[model samples]
Every structure is written in C-alpha cells, then in structure tokens.
Target chain A: MEKNRNRVIIASIVIGIVLVVNILPFLWLVLTSLKTRLDIFAIPPKFIFDPTLKNYVSAFTKRDFLPMFYNSLIIAVSSTLLSLVVGTLGAYSLARFKIFGDKHISFWILSTRMFPPIVLVIPFFIMATQMGLHDSRFLMVIVYTTFNLPFVVWIMRSFFEDLPFDLEKAAMVDGYSRWDAFWKVALPLSAPGLFTTAILCFIFSWNEFLFANVLTAANAKTVPVGIRGLVTSRAIEWGEIAAVGTLQVLPVLIFTFAAQRYIIRGLTLGAVKG
Target chain B: MARVILQNAWKKYGKVEAVKGINLEIKDGEFVSLLGPSGCGKTSTLRMIAGLEAITSGEIYFDDQLVNNLDPGERNIAMAFESYALYPPMTVYENIAFPLHAAKLPETEIKERVGRIAEILELTDVLNKYPRGLSGGHQQRISLARALVRDADVYLLDEPISHLDTKMRNRMRAELKRIHSELQKTMIYVTHDQIEALAMADRIVVMNFGVIQQIGSPQEIYFQPQNLFTADFVGEPPMNFIDCRVKIGQGTLLISFDDSVFKLQNKEKVEKVANFENHEAQDFVLGVRPFYFGISKSITDSERETNFLRGEIFAVEPLGDSKIVHVKSGKNHLLVEADSRFMGQPDETIFLIPDAGHLHLFHKKTEEALF
Candidate 1:
C-alpha cells in the first residue's frame, strides 16, 4: 500500500510539472497581450495589469490583416486540396502497383523536401519571374506543394500500405473497376489520415515566411509577412507583435487540438515503421 | 454455373517463379483447395484464377470463355481475401449490399439478400454497425457473407478461416462444407494448412516450389500418394522413412532393413523387382505412416510378425482417444499411435509391425514412388 501511494505521489508531481510547462507560455501570451506599454515594462512585469483591446484593434484594422488572412487562406486551401488530388493517386500507385523506378523515385521526391528551402529561393524567383507568376498567390501554391507533396505522398502511402491490397482487390472482384475501388473503398477509409495531412500542409503554408516574403509584396502578403511588417525600422510595436503572434498561432492550435487524434497517428506513422 | 480452367498457367516474379506451368480444371459446383506451405505459389495461382494477378503466359477459361484479357470486374467472380475486406466507413448492410448495388439490383432485393446472408453469418445484430465496431470473426463473416451474397460465376476464397481461432476455424469449416453442399457453386479455396485442405476440400491440388506435385481426391492423395513429397507432406505426423534393400532368396523375395527381413508378397511385384536382378539397388527409402505401425504386448509376443522392429519408448503424448508413442528404434526413430487404453511407460521395449497394405517403397535417389 505504501509503495503504491509513493508511485501515485510521484506521478502527480510529474503531471503537475508537465501541466504548468505546457500551459505557462499561453497564459503569458494572453497576459502580455492585454497589458499596456507602460504596464508591460512596469519594473518586474506585473501579473495584475489592466487589460485593454487597443493592441487587438490596431493589430486587425490598421494593419490590413484581413487581406493577409485571405491570402493565407487561399494559398493554404488551394495547395492542400491540390496536393491531395495528385498525392493520393501517386501514394496509392506506389503502395499497390510496382511502378517502374519506384524506390529511387520516392527517395528522390523525399530528398527534395529535405533540401534547404533557402537554396531553392533564387532559382524559384527566377522561374516565377520568367513565368510572370512572382508576387502572385498562384506561385505560393506551387511552392507549398513542393514541400507538402513529399510528406503527403509518403503519409498517404503508409496509410494505404498499412491497409492490405486485398480490400481493393475484393472490391474489384465484387464488380468494381480499379478506379472505382479506390474511390469507393480505399479513399473513403483513409479520410482521417487525409484530413490530418491537409491540416499539416495548411499549417506549413500558413506559417511560411521565407517563401512568402520572397514571393509576395503588397497584394499577396500572407500572415507571417504581415506580422513582419509590424516590425518597423526604429520604433518596434511589441503590443502589435504579441497580438499578431496570437493570431498566427491561434488557428494552428485549434487545428492541432481539433484533429489531435489523427495528428498523433500521422506523426507516429511518419516517424516510425513507415 | 461455372467452370474454371487454367491452361499451362505460369507466374514469374522477376526470375523467381511463383507458379510454374500449372494446369487445373475446377468443375462447376466443386470445391477445390490449392494446398502448400508458405511461398509455395498457392495464393499466386488463386489470384491468377480470380483475375487479380496477370498470368505471365497461357490462358484461363471460365465456362469455355477466355478470361485472360478481362479485368477482375469483367470476370464476374466473387473473392474473399484473407484480410477481412470490409469498407470501414460503411455500415455492414451497405458493405454487403455494395456488390448488389453495383450490379444495379433493386434496393428491395438488395436489402432482402443482405439481410438473409447476414442472418446466416450471424451478423444480423451488426447490420447497422460499421465494420470497425465488430470483432475479427464477425468482420470476417461479414466479408464472407458479402462474397457469397453475390450470385457470381465463381467464388474464390483465400484462406477464409485462417484468421479465426481454432474452434471457430473448425466450426466455420463445417459451415463451409454445408454451404457448399447447399449452394452447389464452383469454389476454389487456397490454404497452406494440410489439415484444413484435407478436411474441407472435395479435391486438392498439392504444389511445392512452384510445381504441381499432384492433383487427386482426398482418398487418392492420402492413401495412394504419387511421390515421396506427397506421402511425407500429406499425413498429420507425416509418413516415416527407413532405408531398405531388396534381396531374393530361394523361392522367396525379401526386403532387408535394420537387422530384419520382411517377406515380400505379390509375385508380380517381385518379378518387377527381379528385373533389377543383376543391378542391385544400393538403398531404398521405406515410407510408412504412424498409423501403419502397431504396438504389441512385448518383444516376445512376435508370432507371425516376420517383419518386426523393436524400440524403446521415448515420449508419450496422450491424444485423448489415442496415445502417440515416440520410440527410438535401431538407426532411426518411429512414431506409433496406440490405443488410449494402453499408455506404455517410457523406456519400455516396444515391438512394431508395419501393416502390409500401408507400407510404401520409394527410389532412394529420385524420391519417386515405387510399388
């Protein structure tokens, strides 16, 4: 009984420490976002500062954040959907049929994602300018797809591989053609995995600053670039930065929490045994 | 309603041959089992017949129509996979009704067929539930019901009961036999388990290393095997082998082995052996199943048993109604399954006599069956 009690006490202490570590930053983000500039620098950073919505008001209205939000949404949505269309077929083909040059091909695709994104920016800029797609949301879709397609193909391939080829064949034997079997049986069953991949792909595209800054200017500025625009030359708007940070991080947090189950499954799949 | 014929069918997975030129004829309303060990191309053969895998060469005919170029859907064959292939998103009713709906059957008829088959598979309670909500057995039966519900030309089942527990496998085996009798549909099943093949199949095609060893009814494969591999691979404990040589004495032919000689009967067989009169066989493998050997009271009870061997009991396994005794005889060991009433103590001397009818002779070099 005493041993069991000791174990419980130890567990509770560890759990308490974890909870504080995980929640402390968000609490600080909220607390600092609400404080005035004077209260923010009140000697030792006061815990009880009077809250105000001035930072949020300035962060939203004056900053042209709405258009930036729309840019991020458009690029992220289109990129995610586009990757799903092509990546799903590629993934299923790799999983089921023995395509020619499959292993080298999959490895080559994965290597592109592993390459430093900064190294590709120069060439990408040149190509985007030549095609007259520079500073356009359309080019961002292509950029997002470049990174997301590898992971998307790999993730969907694993999810499909874990599923036996028998189901699809059984469907075919039940009078469904190959394409019909994929759409009717294989694709629908892998929705949770697809949704998980979509959220991650969207998150990557939304939080991307390097490609966004290099590729966009006035019209197609994403949230991250918009947040960077808050950092002026001399007087830095720390309050606006905090508010923008909250906005940038909010959707991702909600997305992660909403589909946390699938996210964990996807992460484990990509990390191990994949 | 269907007849599946494979003409010199071969499957090559990049030089490693999976199915090597197998010719099979599965009649309408017959249950044929393709039996072998793992990686023996049994599944490859079944997939080829189902139009799932392409035949590297040769042709497959269904009811006198060439189906080599046809897709699986165009073949009109129903197949259940080893993995229970239930669409996880759909309800059990919907999964079962999928084939019927694809064939453009009426909704009412689809519901009726799905309901009846579900009841038969004991899946009626899970009709509204998705496949993920059911147990492995329930999901497997649902898959089976889906395959059986469609009135296709042929049914191809690949180790349908391999996932079930032992008791369920036996129960399902009985159910399958009953269903086959009632439905009278052409079915081809694949399994590596010898017991499953022997118990459930009307005819069996035995294969090894991508070659057809033999094709025969259960009795023909069991009692009269075509080769040494079939004799060894078919039985439960499997047939035992002993080295022997043929010698003809004055007016009698005898085979000698392990310091004992057995008089060979059948003058015609002896005459065939006499053909090798000058050219003597260095050795021959004597094949005998455990059931062919019987235990006597003692080594002294040898009466008319001329071809007798003695061994000390090593292990005694109680098989409920019978005791399988492992005895270490001279130069070799032998298994003797005795009556359950007589459980011989270990290390006791046991004399064994092979039943004349069940004894087998084989060529030592080629492993071919000899008379």
Candidate 2:
C-alpha cells in the first residue's frame, strides 16, 4: 500500500511538471499582453499586475493594422484553398497511382521545403521582379502556395494512405469516371484530413516573416511583417506589439485547437494503414 | 449478365511477381472465390478482374470482349472494400444515391433506387445518418449497399464480409449467396477464410505464391484435394498429415509406418503414387480426415485390413456433434473424430482404422498430391 501510494504521488508530480511546462509559455504570452508598461517591466516581475486593453489598442492603431490583417487573411485563405485543391490531387496520385517520374517528382516536392527560405527568396525576388509581380497579393498567394504545397502534399498523402483504393473502384463501377470517383467518394471521405492540412498551410502562410518582409512593401505586408517593423528609438511600443501579436497568433491558435484531432490523425495516417 | 475471363494475367511488383500467369473463367452468375492465405495473390487476381489493378500482361475479357486496358468504370465491376469506405461527410441516403446521381438519372429514380438498396441492406432507418454515427456492422451494411446500389456487369467482392462478427459473417455470407442468386450477375468473391469460401462460392480457386493451385467445385476441392496445401487449408480442424512409406508386395501394396501396415483398397489409385515414390520415397506425408478414423471394435477385425493402426488414446474431446480423440501411436499424434456417443477414455489402448477411400497420399518434397 505504501509503495502504491508513493508511485501514485510520483506519477502525479511528473504529470503536473509536464502540464506546467507546456502551459507556462502560453500563460506568459497572455499575461504580458494584458500587463501595462510599468507592470510588464517591473523590477522583479509583477505576478499579480493589473491588466489593461491599452496594449491591444496601441498595437492595432500603431501598425497599419487592418491592412496587415487583411493581407494575412487574403494570403492565408487563398494559399490554403489553392494548396488544398492542388495538394489533395497531387497527394492522391502519390498515394495511389504510379507516375512516370515518381522519384524525381516526390524528391523535387520535398526539397522545396528542405532548403532555407532565404536561399529561395533571392531567386524568388528576381523572378517576381522580372515577371512584374512585386508587393502584389497575387504574387504573395503564389509564393505562399510554393511554400505550403509540399507540406500539403506530404501530409495529405498520408491521409489518402489511410483510405482503401476499393472505395474509388467501387465508385467507378457505380458508373463514375475516375475524376468523378475521386471527387464523389474519396474527397468527401478525406475531408477531416484535408481540413487539417488546410489549417496548417493557412497558419504557416499567416506566420511567415522572411518572405513577407522581403517581398511586400506597403499594401501587401502581412501581420508578421507589420509587427516586426514596429521598432522605434524613443519607445518600443510594447503594448501595440503585444496586441498585434495577439491578433497575428489568435487565428492560428484557434485553428490549431480546432483541427488538432485531425492533425494528430494525419500524422499517424502514414503508419496506420498497416 | 457478364462473364469475367482472365487469360494469362500477370502482375509484377518490380522483380517480385505478386501474381503470375493465370487463366480463369468466372461464368455469368457464378460466385467464384479466390481462396488462399495472405500474400497468395488472391486479392491481386480479384483486383485484376475489377480493373483496379493493371495486369502486367495478357488479356481480361468481359463477355468475350477484351477489357484488359479498360478502367474500373469501363469494366462496370462493383466491389466492397474490407475497410468499409463510406463517405464520412455524406448521409447514408446521399452516399447510396451518389452512383445513380452520377449516371445523370432523374431525382425520383435516384430516390427509388436508394430506397430499394437501403431496404435490401436494412439501412433504411439510418439513411440520414453519417457513417461516423453508425456502428461498424451498420457501416459495413452501408458499404455493401453502396456497392450494390449501382447496376454493374460484375460484382467483385474482396473480403466483403470477412471483418464481421462470427454470427454476422455467416449471416452475410448467406445473404451474399442469396443476392448472387437473385441478381444472376457474374460475382467473383475473394476470401482467405475456408468456411466463407466454401459457403458462398460456386467454385473455389485456390492460389499460392502468385499461381493458381487448383480450381474446382467446393466439394471437389474438399474431397479430391489437388495437393497437401488444399487438404490442410480447406478443413475446419484441418486435415492431419502422417509421415509414412509405401512397401511393395505381391499384387497388394502395403503402406507402413513404424510397427503398423495397412492395405490399399484401390490398387490402381495407389499405383499412381509409384511415380512419386521414385523421387519422393522418404518425403511422403499421408493425409487423413478426422471423420475417417474409427475404433477397431466398431468393425470386424478380419475386414479391417484396409487401413487399421494400433494406438493408444492420449486425449478425448467431446464436441457435441462428434468426439475428437487424439491417438498416440508409434511416436506420432493422429486426430480421429468419432460419434458423440463414443465411450472412450484417455490413456486407453485402442485400434484405430482410417478409411482407405478417404486417405490422400501426398509428396512432401513439393507438397503435391500423389493420389
């Protein structure tokens, strides 16, 4: 009985430590966002400081706030939708069919995500300039797609992997063409998986900094770029930064929470077929 | 409605041949099961017929028309998946109605078709429910209904009812057989379970290592097994094999194992085993069914020269319909099924006689049948 009690206490302590480790950073972010300037920079750190919405107001007003929000929204939603459509199809083929250049194709796709974004940004900047597509939301959408497409294919391929090919065949025999079968039978069945990948792609596009800063000038600067440009010599505008950062991170946090089940499932789908 | 014929079909995965050259004829309205163990190419053969898998070489024909390169849609073959792939987002009614809707049928006709299929599959009440809300068995029924909702030339079921519970599997097997009879369309079923294969198949195509081992009626395969594999694979408790050698005599052949010798009833049939003895003399395994063995007291001693053996009972199992008695004779274990009323005791000395007519001789080297 003593041994069992000791084990139970140890397990609870370990669990508590783990829970605190995961939640502490998020707690700090929320607290800092709510704290006033004096309390935020208090000598020993203020644990029970009075909270205010001033930082949020400062953040939104100081950054070209609505445009930044709009830019991020447009880029995230458009790129996510585009990648979902193209990536689902590409992933289906990767999971199901035999392509002529399968090795080069898959390797090329995966390599897009492996190289440092800075390396691609140079060529991307030149190409966009040459093509007369600079600071344009359209160019950003396309760039974000390139950034997210590989991940979309890689993740969604695993989702498609969990499904049986017989469903498509069954649909075909039921008087549907291959395209029809994919659209009707396979697509709807794989919605949760697609939703997960879509959310991931959207979040990645929303939070991107290097490309957003390099490519956009004024009209198309997303939230991340806008927040990073908030540095000043006289005052650093901590409250505004926090508020805008909250705006920048909230959708992703909500999306991550909303689609977490499918994300976990998508991660496991690659191994679950067996 | 159609006959599916595979003429020298092949499927090669890189250098590993999953399905070798094979010819099969699935007659219209025939439920032919491709029965084999895992990795035996049974599912590959079914997939080839369904056009889901591309044949590496040779031709597939539907009603004498070559359909080798045709897509699954063109082949018009309905199939049920083992995973029970139902659209998670769609209602059961919408799912079942999808095929008909794709055909560009009128709304009323689609509704009628969906209703009829739902009724048949007992999924009528759950028509508005999504697949996630349904039980596994109900999902299976919905999957099957979705497959059957469309009018296809052939129904290719790949382990359709394998995942159901014992009671449900048996019930679904009977239902499938009934559906085949009612529809009168070419039906090719594939399964690894011998009971399911035997229960629903008009003919069983036994495959092994990408090759067709045997193709015959269920009874033929059950009784006249082509090889030791079939004998072992087709039975409930499975056919028992005993290592024995044949000793020649004057006019009559003697099969000897340890201190026992049994006379062959059909000299001509046993003579066919002469070819195997030349090469597989030391590699011979005699196959016998459980029901073929009887106690010496049950018959006259003088007439027991056919296949009688002296052994002692090691264990007795009462299985309601029959009693399975384990015999330990000359360092070998043998299974003998006797009447449920068998008054036998463990460790009792008994003379067991195997029916010569039911005994199968096999070449252990190639695991092929000798007689």
Candidate 3:
C-alpha cells in the first residue's frame, strides 16, 4: 500500500509537469491576446492585468481576418472530407482484396508524405500558376488533400485490417452485397477510427503553414498566412498576432475536445481481442 | 428450401491449396456437418457454399440452379461466423434484424422475427444491449439468432458453439438440432469437435488436410470407418491400432501380435483375410475400440485355448461408468474398457479378448479398411 501510494505521487508529479509545460505557451498567448500593447510588453509578464479586446477588434476589423478565417475553414473542411472519401475506399480495397503489388502500392502511397513539403512547394506553385489556379481556395484544397490523403489511407488501412474479415463475410452471407457489407457493417464498426482520422486530417489541414504560405495569397489567404502578414517590416504586431493565434487555436481545441471520447476509444480500439 | 451441391469445388489462396477438388450434395432439409481440425478446409468449403468465397474451379448449385457466379446475397444463404462477427455498433436486436432489413421486409415482420429468435435463444433481456459488452455465449447466440432469423434457402454455421463452456455448448448443440428440425431448412455446420458432429449431424463429412476422408452417418463413421483417418479421428479414447501379421494355417486365420496369436473364428472375417491377396503372411492393422475389449482378472486354462491375449496393466483409470485399463503387451500399449468396480493394479497380469465381430482390419500400406 505504501509503495503504491509513493508511485502514485511520483506519477502525478510527472503528469502535472507535462501538463504545465504543454499548456504554458497557449495560456500565455491567450493572456497576451487580451492584454493592452503595453501590458503585453510588461516586465516580468503581467499574469493578472485588466484585459482588453482592442487587439481582437483591430485584428478582425482593420486586417480583414474574418474572410481569411472563412477561407481556412473552407479549405480545411473540404480537404479533410475529400481525403477521407477517397482514402477510405482505397483503404477498404487494400484491406480486403488481394491486389497485385499491394505492399509496394501502400508503401508508395505513404512515401509521398515522406518527402519534405518544401521539396514540392516550388513545383506546386509553378503548376498552379501555369494552370491559372494560383491563390485560389480550390487550389489550396487540392494541395491539402494531396498531402493528407496518404496519412488517411495508411491509418484507415490499419483500422480496416484490424476488423475481422468475418464481419463482412457474415454481412454478405446475410444477403448484403459486398458494397453494402462494407458500408453498413465495416464502416459503422469503424466509427471510432473514422472520427479519430477525421480530426487528425482536419488539424493537419488547419494548422499547415508551409504549403498554405506558398500556394495561397490575398483572396485565399488562410488564418496562418494572415497571421504571418501581421509580422510587418518595421515592427511585429505582437498583440494582433496573439489575438489571431488564440482565435486560430480555438476551433481545433473545440473540435478535438468534442471528439475526445471517440479519439481515446479509437486509439485503443484493436488493443483487445473481441 | 434448397438442395445444395458442390461439383469438384476447389479453393486456392495464392500458391496454397486450401480446398482440393471436392464433390458433395446436401438434400433439402438435411443437416450435414463438415468435421475436421483447423486448416482442414471445412470452413473454406462452408464459405464456398455460402458464396462468400469464389470457387477456384468447378461449380456449385442451389436447387439445381448454378450459383458459381452469384454473390452471397444472390445465393440466398445465411451464415453464423466462428468469430461471432456481431456488429459492434448495433444492439442485439438490430444485429438479428439486419438481414431482414436488407431483404426489405416490413418493420412489423422484422420486429416479430427478431423478437421470436431472441426469445428462443434466451437473449430477450439483452436484445437492447450492444454486442461488445455481452458475454461470449450471448454474442454467439446473437450470431446464431441473426442467421436463423433470416429466411434464406440454406443456413451455414461455422464452429458456432465451439467457444462456449462445456455445459452451454451441449445445451446449444441440442438447441441447434431442435431448431433445424423445427425449421427444416438445409443446414451446413462446420466444427472440429467430433462429439458435436456425432451428436448433431444427420451425416458427417470428415475431412483431413484439404480432402474429404469420409462422409457417413454417425453410426457408420463410428463403427465402420472407411480409412485410417476416419477411424482415428471419430472416437473418444480413440481406437487402438495393433500391428499384427495374418498367417493362414490349415483352415484357420491366425492373427499374431509379437509372439501372441489369436485365432479368427468368424468365417466371414477369415474369408476377407484370405481374399485380401494370396500372400501366405501379410501385415495388417487390427483396430479395436476400447469398449469392445473384455478384460479378465485371471485367465482359465480353457480361456487360453480361445482368442484371449495376455498383457500387463500399465495403468487404470476408473471413470464412473467404466474403467479404462492401459495394458502393455510386448511393445504395444492398448486401452481396454472394463467394469468400473473391477479393481486392477498396475503391472498386474490380465487377459483381454476383443469381440471377434467388431474387429477392423486395415491394409498396412494403403491404410484402407479390409472389411
């Protein structure tokens, strides 16, 4: 009993340290976003100052951040949906059928994501320019979808593989076609995995900067690029940056917390035998 | 409702031949069991019949209609998977009702069927519960209910009760047999348990490796196995195989094991040995079930003139109804069933005489039954 208590104390301490370390920067950003310009630059960092919404007001009004937020939402959601639809079908096929060169095909799909984004950014820019699709939200969606597809396919494939093929077989024997078996039985059973994969795809497309930075500008500028624009040549608009950063992190936080239950279950889905 | 037939059906996975060319026919309303150990292609054959697996070659028919290219849905079959395979998200009721819904049945009819099956399987109380939290037996019953609730032409069950505890397994075996009789639908059951196959099936198709070893009624499979695999696989405590040489002397057939010789008194058996080629002395395997052997504590001088062979007891296991005595005669170790009250000690000399009418002779090399 005594040893277990001591072990519990040590574990709690480690967990507390990790929580503080991870949350500290985000907490500071939220605090700074609510502070006056002078309070943000205060010595020793003002932890308990009277907060103001002036930074948020300016970031939304003078900088036209709302439209950029809309653009980010559109691109992130569209790209995530597109990736999931195509990748899930591909994953189901790869999981169930004995396709020739399956191992090579899966590895090749994953290899696309291994290439550093910088390596392909220039080529993508040139292609977008040549096709007269530069700086459009459509182009940004396509780019994000291409990058996110491989991750979706790889993760969903394992989820599909973990499901007993017997479930689909049972469904088929119960008078369902192969397609119905996949859609009705396999897909519903994999809800936790789908929820987890969607959240990851959304976050990846939402927070992505390098490709969004190079591929989009002006009308299609996402929140990340819009925040980068606030770092002017003369002086860094720290208050506005912090305000937009808090706003940017808010949706992802809400999305993750809303799906937190499924995410936890999904991560540990196949750990136990049925 | 359908007579199922397999015409030289085969299944191959890449380079591995899972099911060799096999021909079988199941009459309408017949309950046939495919019995074998793991990797023996019983499950594969069931899947092929269900149309869940495409045959690598040859054909399958349902009621004389070719179903080789049909999807499982089109084949109009229902199957309970060995893995249970209950949909995790659905309640037991929905899982059972899923096939009916797929068939586009009326809501009232679907509810009626699901409720009936759930009640029959003793799952009514858990019908609202999801499959994930249920006991294994409950989940298994739900899988069975799902298959039986459907109005398919044939019902296939793959090791449905194999995972249940012994008591539940026995109960479910009787329950399944009762259901088969009530519904009178053609049922194909796959299992590795010989007891289940023997108790439940009208006909048992015993398989080994990827080929059919024998297909016969339980009595036939137990008493008159056509080959070594069937004989060895079917019986509990198994048949004891004694290596013996059949020597024809005068008008009698002398079956000798080591230095001990037993006279074959049955004229029909003597004729079988005589007709099994014209060799003077031929090696044959003598198979005797443990129950068929009569053991005596002391052999009379007159009994030695009969077919009694002598052996020393290796061990004795006293079951309630009978005692299994392990006897060592020279190099052979044989089990003989004796009366439970008969107290026999290890290393005690005993005389065992097999029933002459129940003897099985198999050719040594070919392993085929001689009678």
**What is the Å distance of residue B12 in model 2 from its true position?**
1.7
Residue B205 error, candidate 2, Å:
1.6
Model 2 docking category: acceptable
**For residues B1-371, what per-residue lDDT tens digits would candidate 1 score against the true structure?**
79999999999989899999999899999999999888889999999988889999989999899999999999888988777777766788998999998899998999899988887778889899877757778777888988999998898898888877899889999998988899999999999888888998999999999889999998888987878888888998888888888777764568788887777676765776676535255577788899889787565545455667778898999999888889888888888878898767888887888887787777777777766
Cα lDDT of all candidates, in order? 0.85, 0.81, 0.89
DockQ of each: 0.44, 0.40, 0.67
What DockQ results for candidate 3? 0.67
Model 1 DockQ (Cα-based): 0.44
Model 2 lDDT per residue over A1-274, tens place: 9999999999999999999999886677777889988887887877797789987876666546887898899988999999988988999999888888986888899998887889988898999889989899999999999988999898778767777676676677677888987887677667778877888788788889999899989978888887777777687766677777766778888888877776665333332232
Backbone clash numbers for all candidates listed? 0, 1, 0
Q: Residue by residue across B1-371, what tens digits does model 3's lDDT show? A: 99999999999998999999999999999999999989999999998988878899989999889999988888888899888988877888889999999999999999999999998899999999888888888888999999999998899999999889999998999999999999999999999999999999999999987899999999999999988888889888889999988877776888888888878767877887888885455668889999899898887887778787789999999888988899998898999888988888899998898887788888888888976
Relative to the true structure, candidate 1 reaches a TM of: 0.90
State the weakest 10-residue window (summed lDDT) of model 2 chain B.
Answer: B273-282
Which stretches in model 2 have alpha-carbon errors above 4 Å?
A1-72, A100-108, A119-123, A207-209, A219-274, B133-135, B245-251, B265-285, B298-301, B304-307, B363-370
Name the lDDT value of residue B290 in candidate 2. Answer: 83
Better of 1 and 3 by TM-score: 3
- In candidate 2, position B97 carries an lDDT of 82
Clashing pairs in 3: none
Tens digits of per-residue lDDT, candidate 2, B1-371, equal 89888899999988989999999988888888999999999888888887777899989899979988787777777777777766666788987887777778899988988898888778889999877767778878887887787787888787887767888887888888888888888888888999889888899999999999999999999999989888999987788788878755664656777877777747686567654447435667888898887774455657564567778889988899988888888878988888988877787888887777888887777888877
Weakest 10 consecutive residues of candidate 1 chain B by summed lDDT: B297-306
Q: Model 1 over residues A171-268: C-alpha lDDT tens digits?
A: 89988889999998788767778988889898898889998999888878998998888779987787877777788788888887888776556343
